[model samples]
Target: MEFKLEEFTLGPSIDTLKKCKKADLVVIAESFDVDVPVNINKQGLMELLIDKLTEKGLFKEPAPAVEAELGALAGTPAPLQALPTQTGMSAEELKLTLRIREVEVRNRELEVEAMHLRLKAIEMERGAAVAASPSATQSPSQSPHDSFDVSRHIALVPPFRESEVDSYFNAFERIAATLKWPKNVWSLLLQCKLVGKAQEVCTSLSIEDSLKYDVIKATVLRAYQLVPEAYRQKFRKCEKTATQTYGEFAREKGALFDKWCQACKVETFDGLRELLLMEEFKNQLPDKIVIYLNEQKVVTIADAAVLADEFTLTHVSVFSSPVRREPVSTDRRVRSPNGARRNVTASASARETRECFYCHEQGHLIGACPTLKRKGQIKQTKTPAPINLIQIQPLSDKSTKVVESKKAQIDSVFRPFISDGSCSIVGNEKSVPITILRDTGAMQSLIRGSVLPFSAQSYCGTDVLVWGVKMSVIRAPLHLVQIRSQFVSGEFQIAVRPELP
Candidate 1:
């Protein structure tokens, strides 16, 4: 395959330069009015002519495609053809011919080497040019490919809500514009980025179906429509009840209107004001106030507001300024450090005198008395020293019976159980075995309700030393209980049973 430089650089702008023959290319270059070489071979002649034309700026360098083809040709050598019959050739002439052929091969090799270096230079220049272009300064989102992460960018934006469809869609449109996404893909991207109820409505679709932005908008609108109109109906029905003040009624109606507007995407300021005034004049306020307002011929919201304020001021006393009283301290009496009670009737001087413990002076006491100091009579009184008592005959050698009680090292381990005061209290009604769980920390003992109506003679108060603390207990007498085939006295504590209603 052969390609000419003029094909891409200066030849007619058309696809597939192979359609034009070499002779036609030559003719085209000659027609450019440059001097043409008469004796050069076809390949070399064409290269030289192109170089001259490029130098004169009549033709540009070849395109990258042309340069690639040139490089491939440089790497591959032309096939060798058989020489004509050499029957009459001398030996010396044949030797010279062989030398010339060898030199031509070396020249072609050198040309190929030079072509490679030229191609490398051209590639570096192209790269530098692209790097310096303004388009290189664009952000990833503005790039002409799928380079930016769409999901990550959308995550920063707020999710859409059924009530806030208009605002959400408007913001979405701005985002899509900034991203420069095509219209066909807008709906698909929105569906992918949907959240909340909007996301639930349009679950993810396949890429083929996701491209329909119209379908996505329709689906979202339909979902929004399905949102209940109960708020709107409530707003319409809202009125000032007999007990509700004008301010309270207005606040309730305003709140309901705001909710309805948000759900319905009703954002016009004039429309909202008109709706509020119409509802107020038509149904909310009292008939007398309405008739008075009509008599005054009030029309605008400003006039209606003035009338409402006037009516409230005249009829509602709750909004009037409250009568304030003088703040008085409720404290009855104050005590001085010297145990003197100073009531509210006491004068400041009397109170200060009461605060003085010794001389009854208002400003200074007997110890801190300036008058006594000036008189040189404020002497420090010495306190009596405490006498030390010696130990008398080692506390008289009090005799104590030291009964040695053996404390066997019982290595018994048991898991602690929490008792909910539901254990059965079986007294010695018969010689049956009964289990007793003793909690030394229990505040009171529990008794079964069936063994109620305790006898007054059986109850006795006793202070038992438990865990080094004297704990009060109520001991009651029980019938005889046998333990290990021996009769032992059994006793239970008296417990109160709650009376049933």
Candidate 2:
């Protein structure tokens, strides 16, 4: 534990302090006139001793012999003769302890290196500020490049990342400005840090163009597809990620928008407004419409609007209904049996004047009158002979064939209703067997009260049109009825008629 004062004029090295026990550390501390706190641990005591000794200019650099020994220990196992015997520790234990301490020392060295780098960065920043200031003085012979250390300044910049090329360049530019790095050497510094695709892009350029930082940066960005269109697309499609906060997403979107604006060279308010309006217009349009506009290479808003309107008009015409027209009469006059000329409009006038004899309705004959039919008062009537009727010739074979074909077409178009099935209506004390007609087109089912075996009590009366004849019918609540082998239990309308047709 005792150290000779002459040999220890410069205090023991960190390695030597690490190897010593607590008692040895205390002895070393005393020799250096360093205070030893009673509560201090071995590690703390060593640090205190080292600090005090170094402050007093007593710290010593490791001797050549110690350096050689450390190198040997790191590369190969230590010899038994070199292991300390006074510590009462085995050779293996001491070697393990030394290896662990070596790791700890390496870690501390890394930490110290980081601290030095940070301090160097701070100094560079200060120097840059002073050089930029108007009040600062410098000799005419001295150049700004004299203090510009490319290697050191480059070390402060992060490596180029393919995925984050924009961000990496942003950081590079900031650091270069703070360190007062010469613009002429920016491309060289950037070239050194390029990796992956960025490196490929830089290497692909000619040496002359490669020397220009702008050229190199533009090439790199273009190679990565970070153009104005790309930025705009990213801004439009950027959605908030689950892991990202709203603030982060907003800032990211803003950054992308700025990059897009810069890339597009939108400097003035008008240019920015036009660009924004165009993008918003495209976004608001349907995907198909947007694609159509893109395919047509529409540049102006007016052109897009015109094309959209044309497309809409064309499609609307395709699906629109055709206009219908009333048939025009070609006949102007008719010839009578005596060769007297008569007007065709006179017959139309006679038909307009004609009225139903039963109900006095102008539009229909007595046979077709709905009131007479609904009242069951319709009767067959003979047609009176005309005072001045034209003698009509027999029908032509062609005309008779045309009439028969028309009648057949009418029969084919209108489906005749047939009795679907038989059903029995059960009343208070009686049941009636009736034919069932299933009219899918009819909204409500109606039963003739004249056909019912028992009397039906009318509840609420409603007007129903049967066979183009309006008639009053009442809703009759039937308890149960069997139809088509199925029991139907619901309300049924009972039409009060004289008899079933």
Candidate 3:
């Protein structure tokens, strides 16, 4: 790419040597039109030419027929909206478009580099010319108007970008990658960069009329969000720290908000006046009075005189307000106006069965349940869940042992891991044994990742909508023979693998 320096020292505005020699004599009063050729210093000449030909405003090519462009070039059906809205785009087309976009990005980058080099060359040329000029002052010059002194590195800036958001992101990514950020955090940072670039380009291309700083703000938020998640230790470390700071700020804001009531200069402030008449408001503040409406407790400012259309002191103290209860007519301190004590009033009517600690039901403990008692059912002793297990919830550190033994009684069932070297699994239709791995790292389950066939019903459901297109599910039952079991030695259950399950 040829990088031209418009308005350069040698640009079209370059004054002939005659003009400078004539004009350099302290602007002598000239007769009529100047017969002498005017000479421009390299700096002034470059500036004038650049100002004329350089980008005044971004120009975008006329919007293409988006449908034809996408469908023909990208090989994806274009949605009604230019932005991607549906999954009509096949995976192949998506990959191709991504590649094309990546290439386009590189090309634009070269263009930017070329422009930068042009600017640098123009600057260097002016510097050389100024040094060579004999009339130039030998004394050192200082820019009295410039307040800011620049460093070798440009990164000292805070709200750095006056244009081009990608500058910030590239710098951010460069820093983060150099530090070797954790995988999750790196992913988030990269995504933020991508979105920032998208927004930046959208504005440059005039696709969006307004490109707010929301992109940068969101990137900062996502960067912070990924921190605690990636570095778990900091989650605990900063929890209390942030909480304390927040509390202090909230308290200050709360105090300031209250001052607004007293400063009310309005002549007739009925709400604040009424609120001040209330006993609670008189003692505390205008916002402590509590009332209930539609099962929700509402607090308002008690200083009725300061009540206004915008804010309510009514809800100020709602959090600490007591629930209003109906007055008790009967003396029921000993009983519930019947025979039982106030605490035990609901019981002693019917033979209420005690709940089982094991089964969590009144009828039976897990030990007596058919699931565990069945002859063929494999029973498992109570065990604390393993940290690296299928269950998604965070595990409790505390442990409690069950006093009463509970047994599960169930029809014979089998779960087996099939690992000969590679993987081959077999199962019956109903209750098949399978190692269900839970990956919190993953956003969704890969049902197809499992070798087992999905149930026909599952395939037909809305959940199986493939790429937003409805697809049918296939299901069937099969005996799992190759499965291995940790629960039972040399034992396996006939697992089921539906065609679509």
Expressed as tens digits, the lDDT of each residue in 127-201 for candidate 2 is 989888843566776645566677677677687788898778888999889877789888888899898888987
Best by TM-score: 2
For all candidates, what are the clash counts?
0, 1, 59
lDDT of 1 by residue, 1-501 (tens): 465443333222333333545575565455445565666565665665556655754343333433334335444322233334556868887667655544544555664455556657878999998988856677765534355556656564556666667457768888778877667556656776677767776775555455577667756766666332456677767976534567998999998777766654556877567545654553445555656675775546677778877987887642222324433223345444334554433233433444455555575335456666666653553222211111111111133222111111111221132111212223324332222233455544333323333443333433222121233323323321122212223343423322210
- Write one digit per residue (lDDT tens) for candidate 3, span 375-482: 435444222211212211111224312201111111123113111111233234332333343333432222222454444322322221111113333232322234
**Against the hidden true structure, what lDDT does model 1 obtain?**
0.49
Ranking by TM-score: 2, 1, 3
- Compared with the true structure, all predictions reach lDDT values of 0.49, 0.59, 0.35
Clashing pairs in 2: 11-58
Candidate 1 accuracy as TM-score: 0.24
Q: lDDT, candidate 1, residue 236?
A: 67
Select the stronger candidate by lDDT from 2 and 3.
2
Query: Who is ahead in TM-score, 1 or 3?
Result: 1
Better of 1 and 2 by TM-score: 2
Query: Model 3 residue 446 lDDT?
Result: 29
Q: Show model 3 residue runs off by greater than 4 Å.
A: 1-220, 223-317, 320-501
